[model samples]
Target chain A: QQQVKQSPQSLIVQKGGIPIINCAYENTAFDYFPWYQQFPGKGPALLIAIRPDVSEKKEGRFTISFNKSAKQFSLHIMDSQPGDSATYFCAASRFNAGGTSYGKLTFGQGTILTVHP
Target chain B: EADIYQTPRYLVIGTGKKITLECSQTMGHDKMYWYQQDPGMELHLIHYSYGVNSTEKGDLSSESTVSRIRTEHFPLTLESARPSHTSQYLCASRGGNNEQFFGPGTRLTVL
Candidate 1:
């Protein structure tokens, strides 16, 4: 079972447009949700994150929207630029039985985004 | 950037050979994990270490083994390489609050 599900295996958007990627989870136990961005031949990097208590978080051109009741969340890239073209992954995790989450992430398959200038 | 490193970024070896992938972090994080991934797929956790001399298996059943002799280094070993083992392996370390630092990864090809 895919504990976390992400949509739009690939996305194409115009520069200056807003591109949104969505993700949903089956497990309500998950309390932390994070997004990662990966470039060619590089490891995934933390972009932004949010918790169940918060509905939205913004940092620069990136924002994360969370819906706890729906068990869903999304990443929104404002004023999308060519530099934002990369693979994005959504992940969720719960503090394991011992309350040690340790960032053992359960990730989505990933969404590849391409922005045209 | 997180100070995680992986050696031999790419490896190609014949079957029946023994291979070890090295991973290290200078960030002084106590939690480390190894994940196996195929092209364009979700990563599968294979092994992890909570600290020096502490190790555990992950959700995926893998034939590889890992060791954590020092807090700075974690390495994975495959006793005998097989074609099925060809894939990308990712190493990650976590500090407080479950934020992980990841390495560039090692791509292994077995023939």
Candidate 2:
């Protein structure tokens, strides 16, 4: 059972363009949402994370728009560059201060992003 | 920088052979997890440990076994490798604030 679903399994965009990746989750108990980036032969690294309390969060040119009511979230990369070409994944967890998730992350199908320079 | 490390970044073994994948962390995190990822696919948690002498199977069923005898060391072992077991194995540790850092995954290939 895939708790989280991501669309656009593969995306191609021009440099300096904005590319958006969308994800939808079914588990309402999920409190923490995070996006991770992975390069070839490397492990996934955390890019940004957002809590349900806020509707949006931004870091640098990356923004995460979260809609709690719809149980959907999207990642937007402004000024996409060739360096940003990698696999992206959206994950959710029943996170809490006490570690309700127990460090277990439920990941969605990954999206392979390509930035043409 | 994330201090988590996985040894034998790449491994190729014959079927029916025993292999061990090593993972170590210097951050002293109490929680550690292992995930299996196929090429261009989602990651699935295979195992995890909360602390020494405590290990648990994750949401995904796996034939690999894990042991956590030391806080910084968590190793996974496969008694008999199969072609189907070929995949990338990732190790991660969680800090006090729930920040999980992943190590470069080990790519295993069984023939």
Candidate 3:
């Protein structure tokens, strides 16, 4: 079973617009949620992350709105630009007390985002 | 940027050949993972290690084997490569935080 599900496999938006990518997870134990951005020929880079304790977290032009009750989270890009065109992935992980499963991320299906100039 | 490295950024091999993909990290992280990713698909965990001398299979069943002989190095070996094994392999390591840092993936192709 896919632990995490993401919608809109691909997205297209104009420069200066706002683009949103959403994700939902099945595991209630998941406590950490993070977003990654990947450009072609490069590895995914951590963009921003949030914990269930907070409703939202923002870093510069990127924001993550998280709803604990719904088990849903979304990434919002403000003033989307051509440079922001890349594949975005949402991932979730539970806090392992034993530290064995620590950092074991369950990733959602990625979304290819394109910001047109 | 994370100081992680993957060797042979691209590899093309014949079927039945034995191959090893190399992953190393300077961050000295205790957790390392191997993930397989295909175009337009989600990343699948194939193998992971908690620290030196410890390795475990991931959610996905894979024919490949991994070894963590050194804290900074983890290598994955395939006894026999198959066309079906063609995919991109990604290496990641995590520090004290929950986030994982990924290396440039190695694209493998088997003919």
Candidate 4:
């Protein structure tokens, strides 16, 4: 079973527009959520992250809006640029300090975002 | 940037060949993970380790085996390569903040 589900496998937006990618998880035990960005032929890089305690978190042009009750979270990119085109992934994990499962993340299906100039 | 490294960024092998993918990290993290990803699909965790001398299989059932003899090294090996094994393998290590840092993936092609 896929622990987390992401919508809109691909997205296209103009350079000044905003692109939103959403994800939902079935496990309530998930406490940490993070987003990653990947270019072609490269590994995914940490874009931003959020804890369930806060409703939202923003870093630069990237924002994460998390809804705990609904078990859903979305990433919004403000003032999208052509360089922002890449694959985005959402991941979730539960805290397991000193345990075997510690820091293991369950990833959602990736979203291919394309920004046009 | 995460100081993680993966060797042989790309590999192609014939059937029944034995192969090992190398992963190393200089971040001094206790947790390391191996994930498999196909084109346009989600990443599946195949193996993970919490610390030196500790290893565990992840949710996905894989034919690969992993060893974590040292805190900085985690290697995955396949006894026999098959065409079905063709995919990208990603290595990651998690620090105290619980955020994972990924290395440049190794793209494997088995014939």
Q: What is the C-alpha lDDT of each candidate?
A: 0.90, 0.92, 0.92, 0.92
Q: DockQ scores for all the models shown?
A: 0.64, 0.82, 0.75, 0.75
Per-residue accuracy of model 3 over A19-99 as CA lDDT, tens digit each: 999999988888889999999888899999999989999999999999999989999999999999999999998755355
Among the numbered candidates, top TM-score falls to 3
lDDT string for model 1 (A1-117, tens) is 437999889999999999999999998778889999988777888899888888999999999999988889999999999999999999998744254444568898899999999
Tell me the spans in candidate 3 whose CA falls farther than 4 Å from its real position.
A96-100
Model 3: per-residue Cα lDDT at residue A100? 61
Q: In model 4, which regions exceed 4 Å deviation?
A: A96-100
Error of 4 at B37 (Å): 0.5
How far out, in Å, is residue A57 in model 3?
0.5
For model 3, what share of native contacts is present? 0.74
User: Which ranges of candidate 2 are over 4 A from the true structure?
Assistant: A97-100
- Model 3: docking quality category: medium
In model 2, the Cα lDDT at residue B51 comes to 95
TM-score of each model, paired residue for residue? 0.95, 0.97, 0.97, 0.97
Query: Stretches of candidate 1 above 4 Å error?
Result: A95-103
How far out, in Å, is residue A111 in model 4?
0.4
Clashing pairs in 1: none
List the pairs of residues colliding in candidate 3: none
Looking at model 2 chain A, report the run of 10 residues with the lowest lDDT sum.
Answer: A94-103
- In Å, residue B95's CA in model 1 sits off its true spot by 0.9
